[model samples]
Target: MKPSLQLKLSQHLALTPQLQQSIRLLQLSTVELEHELERYLLDNPLLERAEDYALAANAPTTGDGEIAPRSDAPAEPSESASPDEESWLGEEAAYLRQPGSFDEDDDDYHDVQAASISLREHLLSQLGLMTLSGRDQVLVGCLIDALDDDGYLTQALDELAESMPAELDIAAEELQIALIHLQHLDPTGIGARGLQECLALQLQALAPDATRNLALEIVHKHLELLGNHDFQKLKRLTGCDDEALRAAHLLICSLNPRPGAQYSTADIRYIMPDVVVRKLRGQWTVNINSDAFPRLKINSLYAQILARQRGSGLAGQLQEARWLIRNVQQRFDTILRVAQAIVDRQRQFLDHGDVAMRPLVLREIAETLGLHESTISRVTTQKYMATPRGIFELKYFFGSHVSTEAGGACSATAIRALIKQLISAEEPTKPLSDSQISEVLGQQGIVVARRTIAKYREALNIPPVNLRKSI
Candidate 1:
């Protein structure tokens, strides 16, 4: 080994924090981008959501010349960020520029609710209205804590009692009262022990008889058998005539098994398309959503301010300004790449319909786009594809395939689609049996199992044979 030091020049790929943040923001869905921006605005007093800077997309930026707003959707201007070069935090990044705000967009927060409060919150609010002693309030508090995300109390009283603080002194009777109060809340049937109990609470006001009793037994004891379509066990256990059992089953089916579902705090975020696809002169063309990316420019106003008074940390300030420029550019570039990849693979879906969708796996797109698999996954997860077939999650295009008669690959989704059509077109007086549907698919050389057909039907949220049968 040579001891003397020699001049050497080497280059290595290093992901600086600013670059990493750009990459992360690049792939976020529109809603995710909004949430992230909101969070950053909260944390950084300097950054804002571009409320007054109406110049967002409509404003002009220096790079790539002037981008006009598309007739279909206008672009947004970049967010407000500081050009002030603090000694340490130094220069901040400018947001992506856009053509302008769309003429069609009208803020509608006045009507609909954004993701509702958790079941516990709803219950606690209702609980407060009740006149309870201090000890009773403590017990109710413990019960509220026991509720799961789905709003069921999975833990046994023993476990829950031990988990609670000693001051609560939650006994079984006290717990029962709290449970009653929870059930009585706006979204009924919450705090139930299991699916059976949940449904029972919802149906409590119903008179107990052959029909109601059958439902209780079916939901409580034979729910497993019913799921498996073990008709033999159901016939023996319920001990009702087939017609009576059928009625009972229909009644049970109408109940919401997870009552807390209506009040779920989990955000059911609406999908916003990153790209818009339309058939232009019989050919499918993709348009990247220029709306989401506002026209961002390094606030020359702030830049002029900083340029005149170059302080001691001039190098650091310049680096930040440059870094912000690169980050904004990278964000647009990454979004473009992902949008192109989606348009490339999902053309068939746009041309004909979802039934014509090609088998598009995440890895396939990731490899094609020269992006990491996880990166592609993140880009696609919670992301949507807008087409002539309407909007669908990116995940919907990728499905397991089965061989077809013409020696072509067929998608499980296509098979399910076909099954749904067949079932839907069938006479209500004569529903197609699962086995019969399986036979039909086999004759067509699709070769799906009867069990598989059942699974698919269930996945489509269709009821089984007895439920499907009608008067």
Candidate 2:
């Protein structure tokens, strides 16, 4: 109960700024690492990216520590440079000689479109073409903004009217009218409040026919039954023949459920493989992608100045530049080592397919590399490998083990691939159920549970037996 001063000795690890930067860089994805590098490039004047780090590194240096000029009349272009008869060395060398001499027709100089237009912006563009009063345009604009990414206006008419400024003097009735106008937008179902209304709007757009009428009725009354694939019950309730119901179901299924999703402004992220695996002389070799790496160098001029004057701004930046270069190199080195280990262990997967993927975990790679599990996890998180099949995340090779009858462990990924194959080969009229699939695997010496099969099936996005059944 009494507070007293006590002497205690404790041992703990403290992370330095450089160590923190290393950890952060190790975990960053390709896009994030690019942004981080750009930030450092902007903040530190002592840091600069090397156009050809390999060439600079190999180029002979004079005794005074300066890069010596080439004495040869001319040197051959790099293998990476594309050949061009019009240029002296090559297309790459020509561009490098004149930085602004980029050809518009070149793939690297492609004029990519700006970010995708949002659903609201698309609706507003259509509205701009219409000659409407200012008040009407404002009402429609508000309605368009209220609609969600799926093109459904989730808010109620009353709520929308209440949120508007009092000076506008808008009413729920006006909002309801605006909602109807929004439903007539280019997307066909932009202002629908719910799934039922969305389908109904699409039905209205179809030509007047018995199929459309039946489909409209089905959507209005028994969407739940249609979703359940209770064709018999739907036929009974709708009092339509089998052929007619089938036609109506087909028509309904053709409608877009999420019209606005196509116009989503969300940026499309591209994968940059950290390591590339290629087969050479009947052996798989893993190599780090030079393009994925950012070649960095310390500004020799600033570095020289900082050496004479220690404890200056330039000195701090110089140290940071060195740390950045070292950390980036270490990141790629770790990635290459991990990828090689994976390729070595799962060579069969590359040679054959996912069926040959062995059961592996992060611990295996961590222990093999003499690193911690957390470090391995960070390394593999966003790292990717390019192979003959396709690009795959480094983590894709690691999966939980499932025991086999032969006393061997199989990867869950391999099992999922097997299930996908079984479903694909199944008869349309009588699709294989989860239990049947499990039994099929059991016959192949792999004893998987029915639920596990079902889980794997769902993960592969394979439909249930009822939904997969043919008409």
Candidate 3:
């Protein structure tokens, strides 16, 4: 049969471009949002940054519709100023009034980070000072190049020598001699093949003594015992008493396993909080961070031009720009609302620290703010809140729950905090095991299993009971 056209009336959800943009903007972190805005500014002539606009000083609003103070705004003297603020202002004024305080000509002031030398460069510099023959220096340089960032010679000398050109006549023995020379460099553990050798080299660098010898023996043979905190076996094997073993342990702990790490450049990232929590008039309040909030507006010149001409080519761009501005504002508004809801529920945590944290989930905050769980998840994913306790991701407040004996629920975060507290106060000779920690929490009315305690302990980067024990 031939198909015939049929008229049907059906209703279905469709996301408009504006709605899509709003959702996208809502999920982005503060840094990511800034970058996205910069891209928009580059693409649209009508969209421009309103950094110098007078309204910018009062643009940031808190959850209560009150203007949040700008970080860069000048402070005005007032009778209500606290003593500390008054003193700080007075000191600032004195500093400004001092002679030669202003340097108008120094317009090129900038911070210059000191250039860091890599492990290879450091080794070469030491090699330059040595009086070794050219052949020996070249062989040593080749070995230095083979070392990893952690200062460990992971490749065997035989393998490395085999990899070299046969015309160079390099041998494993020559590489071994070169290794000896390289190990004698400034970083004592530079050419070590493994952790045992690294610690042994450092130990060998120390002055000869009974303690040093014992530590050297342990490092060379019983390193696994020391690592497992099997002090009894170590004492029996080394024939050392408590005092001597303790000293040796301390000495071994002081040695750097990764000598080249100091020269390795670290990637340091900074987090900008979306909202700040503060206690005002005996109540917790949430305020948007001014620096993290994007200040945007339509370019006055382009907007005026578009208004003067009907159906201008930039009309679509103007509409797009307005949509972006509104979506950005809505983004921050949603963030502020969600953050305030979180602070309200987690006020106990702020007042009493992590131990007072209650069980929270995305559904709770989503229902409280009349938003979907997905919206709450997007809002909390990369967003951060700055509180008196510390800067934490918004998602950090929401965790799985554990049942309590009193017919209530406790946050997994709180249980972890309790476990940490118990471990921190445990006797060194006998650190609290996972089972013991579980019992301690059970006694506190929060039921946690040993496996969960171990998981949280590992998450906190805490070692196991066997590894945590001391001499």
Candidate 4:
């Protein structure tokens, strides 16, 4: 066979570095974008933050065209300014001069965060003040260490004693004594073995009375019945009247099952919405949050040097810097476009709350904006919108739909909101069951299955009818 060489041309899609960067930045949240920019700023000398340049706007330039260090003193307003304008400018200057102002570089600016102390540290502090011998203190401290963040001693005393050194001669009874001392800490339920014991400990801490005794007995023995809202069984077993049972139930409800939770360090995440939705002139308007948008610009000094020297080593870096700045701006622009589209679609939700939310999906926004579904997904992934109702991730607006009897569709989110409203208005003694809720929706022409009602109810953290019942 003769070998023949022929050239064939075919086109395939490829992502350029700039396009890849734009996609990546579009998917990142506000905090993550800031972190990504910090990495870029550290690696690229031709990139600088716009905030720094603005802060040094009044400073003199050096021979190399770099801005000189700014002085600590505040700049004064011009004397030629009008009296009214001067007064306004003076007030603005005073605000900017205050501690913890918007200026991150201000020496006196410090974020005020509540000091958090862990459960173990709190228990140890209480132990330190107690009049106990060294050995007793060590044993109590060991027990305190074994407690979980919820203040429950999940480990068995026997297991704890066995895990200790044999030479130390620790026993389960000694650990029990230590447990007793540890339970006497400021938080009443600390060192409890289980929910029943935790509640019992809290109940026992209260002064002796008929209600307290009944509540303690209920916690120790009939807790499961109480949890199931089997009020009849509780009454028969505890031999208490409806009024007494209700009072005891109220007392039990006031006790915190997780006493140590107050001290536990919570991982609180803050969201910076990329866009803010507001009702202006009877129209829902979307505006980009200036703080959430990253302000990036190329280093003018390096750019100037590259422009004059034509074949400088920084030319590649200069181009990269320009690409990043443009890409970041494009990222926010795409986000704003997508967000505005979402706000436009969800205007009913903003006006009348979640129950009025219309069914939406990424495809609708993508088609409206002339973008791909994947692009819309990326734009909404971590991007948030601050609205009158609250801050919600853009993805929250898009949900699957349920068909109604009238040939219309209802959003699952709207259905959930309806279920929540119905349950909130239900009588405590006879809370609406899943089937009843489903029927209520059915009567409204929106057919939702009992299982779906249960699912949405659980998602909303509402208990079942059996558990929601009260005396």
Candidate 5:
């Protein structure tokens, strides 16, 4: 092997900070991006979103018919068109005057609300309310650290207990006490081991009675059977007939599926849509908030700092500045392309509703739009679009396919919607089983297997035959 400077070129994926930032920005949900923007407003002095931008951009357009209203522009272009467009100057000015109005309750778009209370805040408040020994408090804090994003205690009490080495030989009873305290947090079931325990804790917090007791039993003993739609086992074990089990199931159904989700930032106020969609003149269009996506420029302060280098020849500073600008531009392009693809593929979704949505895979969109699967995934990850139906994540449009009799495939999402429709209309007493649903679908010329129907049902959070049984 020759260990000389051969100068052979090779390619490898190097995760540069700029690339990382772009990737990170691509996946951020609308709420998440707003939080990041606020962070930047505090940390970076050079970046600013003010009335002057719209004014300056508009000043040139006023001189002539250069920015005439387009005949093709949708009626609510302000909601769909990029806010960066010259026509959006008025809208941008409106956006700046009243930032607080961005609150979900407020119809105004001008306000910039403060960050909402996070999960940690909710738990910490509960921790303070409890009267535990200082050592016990420390142990509880360790347990909280072991809690998962779903707000469940993911780790075993023993494992979490071990993390509190100082509290070695901790009694299970003491851990249970702390566990009970954790469940009382703002979002119920903050420290539950699993969904069953989480639902049980939430139910216990509700008004206590025989129905509640039945709900608890269903939650603990037959929650898995409940999920599988095993109504017979539930009936056998609870000594309840199908009708009685239906009533019991209703009690459990009333419980929150994700008990810890109340503390989620999604529930905290409203998310300002970066993109808006609306119907106009029988056509659907997507509009980006070019203004909402602030024009990211290097901080003038940082530029001044670099200018004052005084022969220091700081290659690092120069490199960092260039990198930041490139990253900002690249981020915009990535988002813009993704937004376009989303509109192109999901236009039917906008025009009609969920069932009208065609089966769309990430690979199909990625290939059509000339991007990698991972790149498409990154762009769609947490981003949301505001449409007539309501706000939905970018990923919502991408689901598995089910073929029709004509060989055209329907989205798994659409299949789920259809299944939901069927079940919703089914007889309460003789509720549609997986096979029955499949037959119904087959009759409608939708080629699907019972297993496939069940799979889609499961994905849609639909219970099986027994669980769905009524009188």
Candidate 6:
């Protein structure tokens, strides 16, 4: 080690508190932004919602951007202001003017009735109608609880009986009877022990006919062959011709595999778009949703107090409030700019459909906006744009470039859309294979490999030709 220190000078990036806050705010989604603003309002008294700003004659209005010092004088009504011009906190003020006012249509506060009954509740209600001994009902309820969310009783009757309390005296045979009764409940397949049993339960609920009997046979023995789409094996095993097999296949397809899925407890997510795109005078326009961003402003009263008490620990709070406001404004401004650039590039997609989408990359928008590619990625993530067609994520506009024969690049999104269109119009008996799709695209002057087509087809959820083919 050298005893003497050598002079070294280097420059490296440093993220200041303000810069860090700005970067964090830039990455937040609409809901997250609102929560962050709420936190700022709670933490910093100098910051308030924009709707909370109320001006009076007695309160000094600084036109030079300097905060006024606090005075003993009380605020007086402005002569020029209307007699009924109320503050945002006023209860009787119009909601449009009072941004902090509670929304009557807000489902978060109001109790929304359950859309549908739970599987247990549905089964219990049906059980109430049936004349059963309380002991039997208890056994049925235990079996109902044992059934998984997919309406399949995964546990065996003996296993279920063993898991129960010894005082209940529920035998395996009695539990089996209870399960049979439970299976008869609405949704038709509630308590079946397996897939075959579930399908058989559903078949039994249907009217007795040749199609129903054929479906029963297919489900009972050839369910595996049917699942594998091995029509030839099903025909050999069931001794059914193509016509009968097709009818039975259609019947099986019509049945619900997971009968209890209708009662799933998962919450349905609601998306609120950040940007709205529309056409005016035949020119596409992008508008940032003001409602999605919280309305914030510096509290003039607190600002004045802080001005009087400068360098008394309030300066940092004031600076923080200012930084938050600036960062929030910059965040939305950057989002709007990025969204506008995207709309300009994806105008064809808006005009037509996904098929018209041009190849787009994050670099282009980042360069156009004079921002880093990572910044563009952050802007696109968790941000949605509402267009005339439907709402889409900002990232939906960006896709890998696929070159056409004419030396032009097409978006993978557009190619996928094209593949979907071709498959939708394909003959069921002779569905287009991935190679055939690539050939069709080549015919249209778009050069795409069979494997690429297959990848795109799988992404679109279009099954392979064998799986897609109907008898």
Please give the CA lDDT of all the candidate structures: 0.63, 0.79, 0.82, 0.81, 0.66, 0.78
Which lDDT tens digits does candidate 5 get at residues 118-215? 67676777788788888677667767777766787777776655655563777666787777667766676668787787788888888877778877
TM-score of each: 0.61, 0.77, 0.88, 0.86, 0.56, 0.85
Ranked by TM-score, the better of candidates 1 and 4 is 4
- Candidate 6's residue-wise lDDT over 1-471, tens digit each? 769978999999999999999999999988888887888889888777754333211223244222233243222333443433223112222322333333332223344444377888888899989999998898888888877888788888888888888887778999888887898899887788788888899999989999999999989888888877788888988888999999989998998889997886766566767765655445676755534655566777877777787667878887787777667767777888999999999989987899999988999999998999999999999998866577789999999988888889988999999999999999988889999999999999899999999899888877898888788
Distance (Å) between predicted and true CA of 244, model 3?
Answer: 1.0
Candidate 1's residue-wise lDDT over 137-211, tens digit each?
Answer: 767777778888777889987777776777756667667776676667766677888887888787775788878
Which stretches of model 2 miss by more than 4 angstroms?
Answer: 1-24, 35-46, 55-118, 121-138, 165-171, 305-324
Candidates ranked by lDDT, best first?
Answer: 3, 4, 2, 6, 5, 1
What stretches of model 4 exceed 4 Å from their correct place? Answer: 5-9, 52-116
For candidate 2, lDDT tens digit of each residue in 1-471?
999999999999999998999999999988899999999999989888877444221234433233333343123454544333223234333433342343431233445465368778889999998877888888999998887888888999998899989998999998888777778889897788889999899899989999999999999999998887778888889899989988998999999999888877666455667766666445676766545767677777887787788877776676677777777777777888888999999999987899999999999899999999999999999888866577789999999989999999999999999998898999976889999999999999998999999888889888898888754
Minimum summed lDDT over a 10-residue window in model 5 is located at: 55-64
What overall lDDT, based on C-alpha atoms, would model 4 receive against the true structure? 0.81
Positional deviation of residue 45's Cα in model 1 after best superposition, in angstroms:
13
lDDT per residue (tens digit) for residues 1-471 in model 4: 999999999999999998888888888888899999999999999888766433332344444334444464444556765564455345435534552232243222345454378888888999999999898999999998888878899999999999999999998998889899998998998899999999999988899999999999999889989889999999998789999999999999999999888887776565666775655446666755545655566677777788899989987887777777777767777887888888888889987899999999889999999999999988888888766567789999999999999999999999999999999999999899999999999999999999999999999999999998998
Off by over 4 Å in 6: 52-114
Rank the candidate models, highest TM-score first: 3, 4, 6, 2, 1, 5
Clashing pairs in 3: none
Per lDDT, the best of the predicted structures is 3
Question: Which candidate's TM-score is highest?
Answer: 3
**TM-score, prediction 4:** 0.86
